[model samples]
Target: MLEKVAWMNMLFDFYGVLLTERQKDFMDLYYCQNLSLGEIAGEFNVTRQAVYDTLKRAEQVLSQYEEKLGLVTKSTAERNKLATAAAMLEEYETVKSDGRVQQARKIIEEVLEM
Candidate 1:
């Protein structure tokens, strides 16, 4: 469940602008704010079923956007590559103490921060 929430958050971060304002609001409430369906429905003046359906639709839309664009996947892959490069640089630095390796590692860390 935690992983699914994290995945949804990642998808939302990548494709949330494509969603309607209501969709974004519900998503933020349910996922980021950790609100229950009943709670969200109460806040929105709607039924729990209505909130469920809207959330399901939003999830589907986000998943479809990811399927088409793969931005999240690409980003995860790039981060993984950067992490591997940083690790390799660290290992090399341990062996040689090269300032150039340290510089490259710092650059990779900056990119990962993005």
Candidate 2:
């Protein structure tokens, strides 16, 4: 579950970067396919330690880019806004009134714009 969360964050945070082919392949195998380091290494004909190091380096590069440009931070803030809007929608649903639902939908649209 933690790994899933990390991969989701990575996809959200670094999807715009121009990664090398090897880095893209490694990330896809590790995060999209949920492969273990050993499994990824075997697929690439590399040692497990090498695969681990590559992943670590890739993560560091992504982190550096995010820190410098704040893309990840903005994405996280947007995600939080959407989550809050969803909760508001749920609350409005329990009220069972068209006016309240419309107001909540408007709020959701504003949140989405953020």
Candidate 3:
């Protein structure tokens, strides 16, 4: 359940602008704000079932966007690779004070910052 929430939030961060305004609002309320469907419905003056349907559709759309674009997946892989490279560089730096390793580490830091 927690992993689902985390994944949804990450997807929302990556592709939320593609969603309709209503979809964005409901997703934000339900996932980011941790609001219940009933509470969201009350705020929007709609039924709980409507809220549920909108959320489901939004989830589907987000998943589809991820399937096609793979931005989240690619970003995760790149980040993991960069982290691994950084760790290896750090370990090498401890054993040998190499200028090239320090330069490579600096470049990795810059990439990670982006």
Best by lDDT: 3
In candidate 2, which residue pairs get closer than 3 Å at backbone N, Cα or C atoms, i.e. clash?
none
Model 2, poorest ten-residue lDDT window? 7-16
Could you tell me which 10 consecutive residues in candidate 1 have the lowest summed lDDT?
A: 13-22
**Each candidate's lDDT (Cα)?**
0.96, 0.73, 0.97
lDDT of 3 by residue, 1-114 (tens): 999999999999999999999999999999999999999999999999999999999999999999999999999999999989999999999999999999999999899998
Instruction: Give the per-residue lDDT of model 2 (tens digit) for 17-106.
Output: 566677777877877778999999998899999888887777667667767887666877888877787778777777776776777677
Q: Which scores greater on lDDT, model 2 or model 3?
A: 3
> Candidate 3, which segments miss by more than 4 Å at Cα?
none
Q: Which stretches of candidate 2 lie over 4 Å from their true place?
A: 1-13, 89-114
N/CA/C clash count, model 2 = 0
Q: Candidate 1: which pairs clash?
A: none
List candidate 1 segments past 4 Å from native: none
